[model samples]
Target: MGASQTQLRETLDRLGLTVPLADALWVLDPAQPAPSMKTLAGQLHCDPSSATFLVTRLELQGLTERVPDPADRRSKTVELTDKGALVRGELIEAMVAQSPLAALGPEDQAAALQLLRRALAQAERP
Candidate 1:
């Protein structure tokens, strides 16, 4: 797991992303309501301050923006700009290209994805 994580970190770094910021960006959905800072923190499994720091870096890069939540003006949500979405798409493509699974046939890749998703879903359960 550590080796895989290291490889992913290197891949993301080469694409101009830190792991935390990349993780944060990956969670954003431009078509949906933006997630609050607290929700982002929860998704990242990090503290609010850490999430804020990551989001701030992305904001500085012009990839993300903070907007006031409509339901609660006191709270803010992080959103990806068009630029951010482009970067995210590039990141996804890069990751897929670098993936060991890329060597597999299409059917094998589908099977692998299904198995991986099932395992991930099970891991998420209490």
Candidate 2:
């Protein structure tokens, strides 16, 4: 999550976004079709109530909204607004450009990843 933290810092400073809302951007994609509350719960690995709460919070901020699901009129789907899309793009770009390994070449990145994975595995030992 180092990369995420790095990106979050920049985007938060630039956009004046709350930490929770910015973190939720990880699963929110503008290019994708709107996802139902159930689908978002699955993606966030939380209960339906938690997902609803998160969606509500984002909606309050004008970052997301609940719309009628095309496939099921009774159900609602979540989608980003224009402002949300812009913020998402900025978050994505910052994440990429400010990654811990951004300065590394492909080969060096791969090599570093291997070493990091090895260290992580060793650290996981009980």
Candidate 3:
């Protein structure tokens, strides 16, 4: 699908996130229960070195912080800072405001959301 890169760029610009796609993905997964550099790398299908680089950049920007896992001194966990939370909230609001759901009639939007929930149910498959 050749979607609108222009729209995508404009949307990202509105959100003030200049990171590339991989870093964007990392930002989106901020609320995972136990997020880590390793987990992010696995999700992005990138190498550990690349993941580290992404994490370092985000950390430098103050969007994320690496805290030592209290239970394991050798391990660390990644968590979004207050700034990240605010950015995520704004991004989500912008997305919802621009999405087709708002333009669709209420009845149609409800039906579409129901189908989307059903599609979400397919996550059980391996």
Candidate 4:
């Protein structure tokens, strides 16, 4: 079969994250400036403490920052710094580079995308 969640987790761990899903989400939403921990925890389906711990880990790596939320002073928001952005870009690029059709010519790549889109559409059906 295709890659399982565990396999994806391992790949993410290899790239230097204890919780790859959370990190990847933040990276993908870089325009957030700084997303609140509550928001992130909700997105990850985890408790606030767990999100705190993950953010701490990323902060220690100079990949993310925690700042006071302007909208709600009591809340804190997390954002990727310059280093974080660089690492995020690299990680995204690496993942894309490893795609199955990476070696295909442009026409074949287009066909592959079309096929994958159809599969995705089918899977989204109830």
State which candidate has the highest TM-score.
1
Ranking according to lDDT, highest score first: 1, 2, 4, 3
Q: Which tens-of-lDDT digit does each residue in 1-126 have in candidate 2?
A: 765675567677777666656766668887778889999888888888988988888888788899999999999999998888887888778877878788999999999999999999999999
Each prediction's total of clashing residue pairs, residues at least 3 apart in sequence or on different chains, is 0, 0, 0, 0
Scored by Cα lDDT, where does model 4 land? 0.72
Candidate 4: misplaced stretches above 4 Å?
A: 1-15, 19-28, 101-126
What is candidate 3's lDDT per residue for 5-121, written digit by digit as tens? 333557667655654532444454555654666766776677878877777776776766788877776877677788766766766665566665668998999999999888888
Find the candidate with the highest lDDT and give its number.
1
Residue range with the least summed lDDT across 10 consecutive positions in model 4: 1-10
> Residue pairs in steric clash, candidate 1?
none
Q: Deviation in angstroms for 83 in model 2?
A: 0.4
Span of ten consecutive residues with least summed lDDT in model 3: 1-10
Better of 2 and 4 by TM-score: 2
Error of 1 at 120 (Å): 2.2
- For candidate 3, the TM-score is 0.71
lDDT for each residue of candidate 1 in 42-71, tens digit (9 for 90 to 100): 989999999999999999999999999999
Global lDDT of each model?
Answer: 0.86, 0.82, 0.66, 0.72
